[model samples]
Target chain A: MSAPGAVVAAPEGLHDREFGPANAGKVGMWIYLVTDAMTFGGLLIAYASLRRMGNWPDPAEELGITISSVATFILICSSVSMVMAIRGAEMANRKALLGWLGATIAGGVIFLGIQYYEYNHLVHHGLGFTTMEHGNNLFGSTFYAITGFHGLHVLSGVIYLTVIWIKSLNGRYDGDASHVEIVGLFWHFVDLIWILVFTFIYLL
Target chain B: MSEQSHSTKPYLLVWIALAVLTGIEIWAAIAFDGTAKWATLVALAVAKAGAVGWWFMHLKSEYGWLKFVAILPIIAAAYAALLMAEVVAR
Candidate 1:
């Protein structure tokens, strides 16, 4: 024990003790992701439960699989590009980082565009939020609730990526990868949620 | 950190595997019906999601505690599925 009112220093190895090697930002991101996942989980479970109650239209028949499959493939491609962007950041290759990040952003934009087209097409065909021309009303509500929430995520992700891309353009992340990695976590998470959404909402 | 020196080949491989799995999912959806189709689709979707979490999210290389943190939602999902099963049983 130190003398009374003495300013004692922390032990050698105990100083700056963090949650393992992950920085606070990464840990916080993970925690946020866990919570977000639970939200999606709740929605999905509700979807499944309501689906089990019968009168649910065939997803493929109601929402064409071809377009959604294409969207899924695009999202997958964006995930790959995201990994490459992180790799570039890790290697301190500014050009590769910017290029891959740009590609990832492009993928996200195209996805949103496709989603817009799909929503318009669906609405034009009488798939309103509370009414489906050829199926149960719950289908429209749940489908919009799930995919619309995801679309908002994609939109926010694109904006986030755009900000990061601007910072990269300004040479802000030249030698530091922590920020890029943190944002990558969010972007990848959006993709991950989409995977579940596509399966639950469109395929099954 | 040392493993960071590896090339992007693994990412490419994972992407290819995801595409292939998706193709299989579409095919299964078209060719199968009933429990078989549901089982196949659900299995493939879970596998694909796992691949993304394991590789793209770097969960495979993260700390063990972080991995546990990441899997919290899976536990919740399982519970939800169990409840749904009970509902179905009723």
Candidate 2:
């Protein structure tokens, strides 16, 4: 099918036309999210297996959902701020972008902080990864592995946004406002994954 | 540049609503019992996920190909969910 501008067919799978770096970035993030979703799927499968086998202990005895819930809220808020940052960048309001990006980074840091706190809290409750409360189960391992990987992604994204934020102060990317948009896409993907994580690990 | 409006209000409002929904989730997590809690949590999670995908990620703004990209994984997730139900049900 041909459009108004250019009639370049995007083949079977690849993006049809180059959508600038921002569009490319967003697309790349979505691709990454698909793979990450599979990983979470595997983890959820494992969780189901363990729960079926009667492996998981009581929440009051083993894990803390409240902390995870709070982190979920923080991450969701950060995603909002990230969209604002992208908007600011598009309007060439460097100061507003920086402020929003800084907020995003702070949210990432707070997420990591709370993750560690929850980790320690779980350990204190006698659920430190290797130790199993009810049966010698894979609950802790799967839980830590899944959430740990997600946390690492958030950390890397935080660093990426921070660098983007610092470079914005130097006025390097004047016309490429899509860079922030791409970062927002990545950040939102991270937030989306956490939404799944929070539901599977905590609520269900 | 594309003429897409860059207003941040929709995403922001959705974010606030998600936060409130999360608060309700936590409250229901502690307050409710049995099937009621499970049903509420799952419903809220599905709603929140939809908002994030539609608004924050701008999936609603993109071409159909993007939706194709998104729906494939979700289709796989449906199968996975079936497997989960089978495993947990046994």
Residue range B2-76, candidate 1, lDDT tens digits: 565466788899999999999999899889999898899989989999998998898988865778899999999
Off by over 4 Å in 2: A1-22, A133-136, B1-6
Models 1 onward score TM values of 0.92, 0.86
lDDT of 2 by residue, A1-51 (tens): 432332233445565443422254466667778887788778777776776
Candidate 1 wrongly placed segments (more than 4 Å): A1-18, B1-5
Whole-model Cα lDDT of every candidate shown, in order: 0.86, 0.77
Cα error, residue A14 of model 2, in Å, equals 16
Candidate 2 residue-wise lDDT, B19-46, digit = tens = 9998888888788977898889888888
Specify the highest-lDDT model's number: 1
Q: Which DockQ-derived CAPRI band holds candidate 1?
A: medium
DockQ of candidate 1 against the true complex: 0.67
- Minimum summed lDDT over a 10-residue window in model 1 chain A is located at A2-11
